[model samples]
Target: MKPNAAATAAALHYTIVPKDLAGHIFEVTLQIAAPAADGQVVSLPAWIPGSYLVRDFARHIVQIRASSGGKKLALKKLDKHSWQAAPCRAELTLTYQVYAWDLSVRAAHLDASHAFFNGSSVFLRAHGQEDQAHVLEILRPANVAGKSWRVATSLPELKAKRYGFGSYVAADYDELIDHPVECGDFLLATFEAHGVPHDFVINGKVPNLDIDRIVADLKPICEAQIALFEPRTKTAPMQRYVFMTMVVGDGYGGLEHRASTALICNRNDLPLTHQSEMSDGYRSFLGLCSHEYFHTWNVKRIKPAVFVDYDLRLENYTSLLWVFEGFTSYYDDLMLVRSGVIDEAAYFKLLAKTINTVTRGSGRFKQTVAESSFDAWTKYYRQDENSPNAIVSYYTKGSLVALALDLLLRTESAGKKSLDDVMRALWQKYGRDFYTRSTARQGLGEHEIAALIQGATGVDVARFLAKYVYGTADVPLAQLYAGFGMALDGAQASKASLGVKASRDAGDCKLAYVYEGRAAHLAGLSAQDVLIAINGLRVTAADVADGLHSAVGRYRIGETVELHAFRRDELLVVRAKLQADDMPALSFTVLEQAALLRPSWKKTTRR
Candidate 1:
C-alpha cells in the first residue's frame, strides 16, 4: 500500500504549558486538522514502554473536554483512559488538565524549581491519526518564578533553536512519545562520540561537579558501543543523542529510549571537583550509563516480538528478557573494561559481585529467569518482603547466563568467537532499520536465540537453556571459571550467621530479611523484629555492629544465646544458636599462566 499522503500531511498539534507550580498541574491542548467521520476515540496509555508496570497514567488526568469550531462537543467516557467526541466530523480540539506529581522516570513531575514529562503523561494519542506527523509546542511555564529555563530532549526542533522552547516535530505518535522533555535551569555539558553530538544535562543542586571526568569516562564507552554494532561504519543509529539525568540525595535508575535515556543518580555518585579517584558510587553510575546505552541496540531496536507492537491497554508478556535485558547486563560492565575505564582486576571484582549475588539468592532454585520475565508485571516489579525467598532477578541471573554463554563460546572456539558475534548478528538481522517499516517489522522469537548463537559460533546451547533458563538449575560459575585459569573463593566471609539481614529504622535495629529454615527463622524471629538486648545487655540500631559481635563473639560455634526482641509490641526472649555466616563467596582471582589469554581494552576485536 502507498502512503496516505493527505493524512500524513495534516499533523496533530499539541501545546503543553506548566499551568500551576504549587498544585503540580500541566495544561495540555491537542488539536487535530480532521476528526473521524463518526467519532474520534482518544486515550492515554496505561503504561509506557521500558518500564513494565501498568501505571494507569490516565488517572492523573483531572478533567477533559472536546470541541469543534469553537463550539462544545459532548465528550462521553468510553473507559478509564478513553474518551469519545460525540459524532464530530469537524476538526477536533481537546483540552485536558493533567496532575503531575510523581518524581520517577515512568511519569511526569512538576515543581517550582523544574518540570519534566513524558508524552504518555501529557499527550493523548489521536486514535486514527497516530501514523501522521505530530507537532509539539512547549510553552514556557506560566507559573515559574525563578531562574531562566531551557529545554532538553532528543525531539527534533522544527521552528525552535536547539534547546529552545518552541515547536518540535516527530514522524509519528510512537516517535513523539519516545522523546521525554525536561524544563529547568539545568547544569549542561556537550561532548562528541564518533562525530555524533551528545548532551549531558543534570537538574539538581550538586556544586563543583567534575563534568570533565564524566565526559572523559563516557566518551570511549559510547564510541565502543557504536563500533560494536556497526563495526564497518562506526555509525550510531541516532543522528544525535542526549543523556538527561536527575541527581537526588539517594536515587538510582534509568529508562532507555531510541535517541536518549532518562536517568537518576545520587549526587554523591557524581565525581566531585579535584577528585581523581573513582569511588564505588561513581563506578556504579558509570555501570548504569553503560547498561542503558547498551539497550540502544537491545530492547529499543532488537526487540522481542511481543514488544514490536505494544498494547498499552494491558500487559505485554515475553519470556526472552534474559536475552535482551540479560545480555545488556553482561555487557554493561564489560564495556567499562573494553573502553579502558577500569582495569582487568576491577572488572574481575565486579564480575565476582554479580556471581555472588545470584548464587546467594535462594530464589534462583525456585524461579527461572524466563518465568521471572513473564511474570514481571506482578512479581518482579511489585515485590514485597518475601520477594528474595520466592523470585530471582532476571537482570542478575540473566547476566550470569550471558557470562556462561560467552565463556562457553570462547572456550569452544579457542577465543575466536564470543557473545559479541551473536549480538552483532542479531542487530544486523533484526534491529537494523526495524522502525523504518511499520508493516511486518521483524522481532526475535524465543527459539531464534538458540539458532543465532549456533550460527554465530557453531556451538549448540539447547541443553544449557533447558537446565538454566527455563529450568531452575544454577549455572556452575566456579567450574566454568576454573577452565579459564581463575579461582573462585567459595568460602563464606565469616562463621557467624543470624540468617537475618538487619537495617536501621527509626533508631532501632530491625530485621530486614529472614531466610527460610535459618537460625532466625527457626528461632521465631521475623522481619521487622527490633532487637532490644542480647544476653541481658541493651542494644540499639547503631550498637548492632559492636553489640552483636560482643553478644555472640564470646560464644563458640553452636553455642546458644538468649535474644530479647520486640515483635510489634510483644517482647519475648528467644534462644538462637550461632551458625555459619551465609555471606556470599568472594575473592575471584586469575591464575598466572591463564592471565595471558584474558582479553583487554586494546585486544577487543570483531572476531
Candidate 2:
C-alpha cells in the first residue's frame, strides 16, 4: 500500500499523562479504532534501539485493563511482553500504568522535578496495525508542581502548539518510538544548519549555562556531517532535529534516534558564562554530541540487514556493527577537526586516547571486531569486572579498523578516494531516500560491505577485511599513521605497577580488576580484594586515589615485596614481584615534510 493511504486509514490513538509525580507513574491509554476480528494483540518492546540489551521494558507496566463501549473486556496474557484482549466490535481501549524510574536515556524516568520517556517504554504496539499512523496525546500534569513544564520531542505536532503539551502524530509505530519525549521547564535554544532548524533542550538546573556557545559549536559540526553525506546539495535528511539532554552532577551517555538524540551529561560539562577556554570535560561533551549527530546518517538510517525490521521482541544479531557504529566513532572526532572546532594537536590527542583504549585490553588478541559486533548483546552491554580481560569493544577497535581502511584507501587511490567516498556511497545507496521512499527501505548486508567498499573507492578491501575485521589481527595502526605522514609512538609510565585497577571503597583500597598475566594476577590477588598494606607500609584509600601503581612505584622492578590484603574479611599476606607499568600510552606527531603531500589528512574543506 502507498504511504499516504496507509496513514489515512484508521490510526492507533494513544493518550499518556504523567500521573502520580511523587510515585513516578505514567498512565497510558491506547485506543484502536479498528480492532482485529478475533482479538487484538499488543506488546511492549523488549529493548530500545542503539543500546543492545534486552531490557524487558514490559516489566515496568504496573497495571493494565481492557474495555469496549463502557463494558469491561477479558484480557489474557500472551507472553512476557504481549497480551490479547477478548473479541470486541466497537472501538477498543486499553489503559495501563507504567512505573518510570529508570534515569538513563534508553528508558523512562519521572520525579517531582521532571519527566522523560521513550515511546518504546510507554506505548504499546498494536501488532497488526504497525503500518498505520500512531497519534500520541501528552496531557500536562494536573498537580501544581508541574505547572511550568514544557514538552520537547521530534514527533510532529498534530493539534498541539510547539513545546506545549497536547497531541502529536507519527508516520507509523516505527517512527513513533524513534522520538523520545522530555517534559520539563528546560533551557531551549535554536540554530540553523544548512537551512535546517535544530533545537537544543536541556532539562536540568544549570546556573549560568552558555547556550550561545553551544549553538555556535554545534552548527559547523552538523553542516560538516550534512556535507559529508550530500556534498553537492548540502541537505539534511530531517526537516527539523533535536538534541534533548538531561544534566546531573556526574553522568555521560547518549542514545541516537531517527531525528533526535537523548543525552545525559554532568553539569560541569556545560560551559559557564565566565569560562573562555575549552576544558577537557567540555571537549569530551562536544565529542559525544558530534558522535550522536553523525548517527543521524549512519546507523539511524544505514542499518544492518537484520535491523531493516527490528524484532524488538528478541535480540537482533549482526556482524556489521563495526561499519555502522565503528565508522561513526572514527568520524565523530574527525568532524570536530574538520569543522575547525579543534586543531590538529587536540584531534591527535583524542585519536591517541582511542588507540590506547583499544591497545590496553588483551582481549583484542582473542576477539575479532566482527565477533565483538555479533556478541554485543551478551558481552559488550552486559560487561562485568573481568570484561577487559575477556572481551574486546567493537567501538574502540572498530574505530581503529576504520582508520586503517581510510589510510589504505588514501594511499592506494592516490588520495582520490577515501573512507569519505565509501561513506557517501553508503548514504546514497542505503540511507539517503530511506524515509522518503518507504517501499525501498533496505539495510546493508553483512557480507556485502567488502563489495560496497570496492565499488565506491575502486579499491579491493576483501583481504584487509579478512585480516582486520574478521580476524583477530591488530590494525597495524603505527604503519598506517606513518603512511599518512604521522608518527605513532607509545609513552612509558614513570611508575611501577601491580597491573591492577583499584578504586576507593569506604576508605579501603579495593582492587577492581587484576589484569590477566600481570603482576597482581600472578601474585593470586583477585578483584574485590581490599588492600591493607604494601611491604609493611599501611596502604590507605588515599594511596589508591593517587594511583594504584604510584603506591607501588617506590619499589624497583622485579623486587619482591610483601602485600597484605583482606579477602572477604580474611587477612592474607603474599609476596609479590613488582613489574614495570605496561599500560598503553600512545602519542602522535606530524611529519611536516611528508604531511605537506597530503593536506587533506590534517584539514578538511569547510563550507
Candidate 3:
C-alpha cells in the first residue's frame, strides 16, 4: 500500500490574513479523524495533483500541533510530512502556518500585501477513509477593512457573507484534492459566451494592459470549442469556467483545473495591435494561456486510465501524454488561427518553429513519445545539461505526432473527416452533465478515449503506441509530414563558411554551439568564446542572425558583407560573402488542385 493510501479529510478551514504580520501570513487548519489503527500515521502531500514530483511540503510547515477531543496529543515526526500521534480515541485537529513571500502560483507565500496557497502546502489529508465528505472555510483579516476581494476556486462557492469567502463542500477526498483554492485582493471580471459564465479573478490594480481586448480575442477560441462539442451533446458537464491570473511579473505559466485555471503572467500577453512588434516573451505567454485553457476538455475530463485515478504517493505512468498533452499543444496554436486570432502565414510560421525544434532535438532519436511520458517523473521533470542529448520531451514530440496523425486522417479520409471529430466523439462518450450528477464519485478512464480513437482512426494505434510510445524508437517524421502537405527537408551541414551557430548564451554574447566544417569553423571560431563585437558593432548572440540578415536584407541577391567576431579570445575580422541561401530553410507550399478542397480528413493536396 502507498504511504498515504487510506488518507482522508473530514473538514478544512482556511483564513486569509492580509495584515497578520505587517500584512503577511495565511493561517490554515485541518480537522480530521484518527486512523483506525493506533500505530498508523497521517501526512500532507509533498506535491499537488496535475504537477507530479514531491515538493516536501513539510519544509513550509512552520508550526504543527495535533490534538484529540479537548486534550492535546503529543505528535512526533516519523519522517517528513508524516507524524506519529499520541494515544487518542477522539477527533483530531492540525493547525499550521505557511509563509507567503513569493508571488508565484505553484507555492504558498505571505507578505505585507496578500496571500496565495497551492493547497498541497497547507491542506492535510486524513490518514485513512478518503471517501468521507469534506468542507473548507475561509476567513479574512478583520482589521483591514475594505470591500471583499473576489473569491475564486474550482470548487463551488457557498453563499456566505462574514469571512469574505464561505465554505466549499467536497463529496470525498478525491474531489477535495482536485479543487485548489486561491483568495486575495483582486479585480473580478466576468464575460458570458454560449450562455456559460466565465470569470477572471485577477491580482494587482486596474490592469494597465487591455483587459476587454484580451477577453474579446479569446471569445472565438472558446466559442469554437463549445460549438464543436455541444453539437455532439447539448448539455455539457461544466457550469462555471474560471480563469485566475497575476499580472505583475514577466515570467508566467498556468495550471489547468476542471472548471477553472490559475495563470501567472506578464502584461505583454495582452493582444496589442502591433503584434509583430511585440517581444517573443509575449508570444510565448499567449501560447501557454491557450494551451492550459484547452486542457479543460482534453486533459481535465477526457483523461488516460493511468491518470484517471491519480496515485498521490508516486508517479502515475501514462503512454498517452503524447495524445493528451501533445494533441492539446498542437491545437493551442491552431485554435489561434481557427479563431482568427492569427493568419495562415502566422500559423505556418508557428508550425515551422515546432518543426525546427523537433528536427534539432537530439533526444528524438533516443526516446519515443511513450517512453518520454512514462519516464516523465525521472527524466522529463528533472531536466539537466545532458537532457538535450538523452531525453525527448513528450510535450514537443507528442505535438508533432498529433500533427502527423491529423494530417494522415485528412489524407486517408479524402477530406471527409478530421481530428476534430475524434475530440467530439470522446466528449459525447464521457462528458455528460457533470453538475446534475456527481463526477466526484465517477473518476474518468483513459482507455475509453483510446478505444474510441482506435475505432475512429482505423489504425491499430494501440500497437503503434506500444512500439513508439513504450519503446525508444524515433517517430517516422519524414513519412508523417508527407501526407499533411508538409515535409522536413532533412538537416544538411550548413555552408555558412562558419562552423558555429551563435546565439545569446546565458545573458552574454558567445558562441552558443558549433558544427564541424562550417565557414565559422574554416574562419577558426570555437565554442565558449565570448563574442564581444561583430562587424565593428558590439554584438550578442541575439543580434548575430538578425544582424546578419539585416546586412543582406537590403541588398539584391549575390550581396557580400564582412563579418567580425571575437574568436580565440581575440578580436578577429572575417569576410563572409553572402549567397542566396536555401540550405537551412524548411518550406511548405500549397499545391494547386482542380477544385477547392476544404480542410478535412480525405482530400489530397496536389501542390
Give Cα-based local distance difference scores for all models: 0.85, 0.89, 0.61
Which 10 successive residues of model 2 have the least lDDT summed? 592-601
Against the true structure, what is each candidate's TM-score?
0.95, 0.97, 0.78
- Model 2: how far residue 284 lies from native, Å: 0.7
Query: Order the candidates by lDDT, highest first — what do you get?
Result: 2, 1, 3
Tens digits of per-residue lDDT, candidate 2, 142-216, equal 888788999999898888999999988887899999999999989899999999999999998999999899999
The regions of model 2 sitting more than 4 angstroms off are 1-9, 593-607
Candidate 3's residue-wise lDDT over 340-397, tens digit each? 6665556666777776766555666788777777787788878754465577888877
For every model shown, the clashing-pair count is 0, 0, 30
Arrange candidates by TM-score, descending. Answer: 2, 1, 3
Model 1 stretches with alpha carbons more than 4 Å out: 1-9, 143-147, 544-555, 592-607
Clashing pairs for model 2 are none
**Predicted structure 2, TM vs. truth:** 0.97
Q: Each candidate's root-mean-square deviation in Å?
A: 2.8, 2.1, 6.4
- For model 3, state the Cα shift of residue 481 in Å: 5.9
Better-scoring candidate (TM-score), 1 or 3 = 1
Backbone clash tally (model 1) = 0
Best-fitting candidate, scored by TM-score: 2
